[model samples]
Target: MQTQVRVRGARRWIMFGAIGFGALFLVVGLILAGVSVSFLANAERARGTVVALEWRNDHNGVSRKNRENDEPVAYPVVEFTSADGTQRSFRSSTGSNPPSYEEGERVEVLYRADSPEDARIKGFASLWLLPLIFGGIGLGIAGVGTVVALATRGRS
Candidate 1:
């Protein structure tokens, strides 16, 4: 029947979509992981202090229950002395709703010799979280696609 044929086609499309999206995520995750690894390998480590927390309004429009009373996120500004004894500071790209660090807190910093201004606070959240999330989602999506494909093939 034409209806049965259309159903099969639709299922096939869904399977392909899942696999395609999964592969995309997997590739991105791999690339990000690679970059993180490279950075870690080449970066110079130093002790630093949290000098200040820069507050900014959440513009990403993540809805909160008390939208009008939304508090600003806090991004830490770290100050560190490079190997060559030059003073440097950089604001962290990641932020938290509740302040994650207090001013005067000591932390480890990772930076490149060439560009110490683009330094990062060395932590799992700063580096590994994104790649892990993407890779996990990719694997789950690809697994679902594989299951659907196998089921459809069996029915055929």
Candidate 2:
């Protein structure tokens, strides 16, 4: 009888914790989605060329543990001609170990007329990936909590 009571208590705590964390993640995802939408709303599109690849090393604690396994990430430097006939160059915020683009590759860029320096690469991964990931995780976790609560309700 006592063990059953303890199990019920543990399940209750687990359910509440999952629900709480899930809600937090959901809110963060919503906020990120909102920011992305706002950025796209004021952005103008232009064609850009990859001028260079900036290689950077991940010198964090985890990477330090495995020196042989560590590889430098390549961030592309893109140059574009703005609407006002001014040439601007900016480095992409996204990077990959294998280098996603060649030096001469042409890609789309999204920027505001007021501040072309703050432009970003116009792609689904650059803009929407984070929100989708967070929202998906949040929903999954919340669903787990709901399932647990429902399955154990009758036992208690």
Candidate 3:
């Protein structure tokens, strides 16, 4: 009886963990999706003047194999002045493809002023991509949690 109780407790903990993870993912996804939508709606968006551009050797999986071959890859990046008249720097990401311009090139972008990291240099902030991925994971977790919770509730 004691062994059975311990096993049930462990299962209960697993269910709780699943629900927790699911809720977290869902919340984060919804927030990101909301931000992306808002950025898309803005008129002026994140228009800026490119002041600088450069590349650094920050290792990534895409370049991991090349790193072993002594390959020095140049990552395109841009620094620009926001509408607020403040200068900041942003590097390109896989999410935003086809970098718009080079250093000293004036460009228009749509990014969150407060969090420049959450930005789309060429277009609107497409935070939706991450959110959608997370949301799908959340749904999967939620479904599993629901099943476990249902299955364990009566027995415990």
Best by lDDT: 1
Clash pairs for candidate 3:
none
lDDT of 3 by residue, 59-137 (tens): 5665666665443334345565666777666665532223445556666666666666555566433345677888888
**Poorest lDDT segment (10 consecutive residues) of candidate 2:** 58-67
lDDT of 2 by residue, 1-156 (tens): 999889778879989999888888888889989999999999999999999999998666665766876789999999999999999999988888899888999999999889889888887777998999998888889888988888878766
Clashes of each: 0, 0, 0
lDDT of 1 at 56: 94
Error of 1 at 96 (Å): 1.1
lDDT of 1 by residue, 16-128 (tens): 99999998898888898999999999999999999999999876766786577678889999999999999999999878878888999999999999999879999887889
| TM-score of candidate 2 to 2 decimals | 0.87
Q: Score every model by TM-score.
A: 0.90, 0.87, 0.57
Q: What is the lDDT of residue 98 in candidate 2?
A: 92
Better of 2 and 3 by TM-score: 2
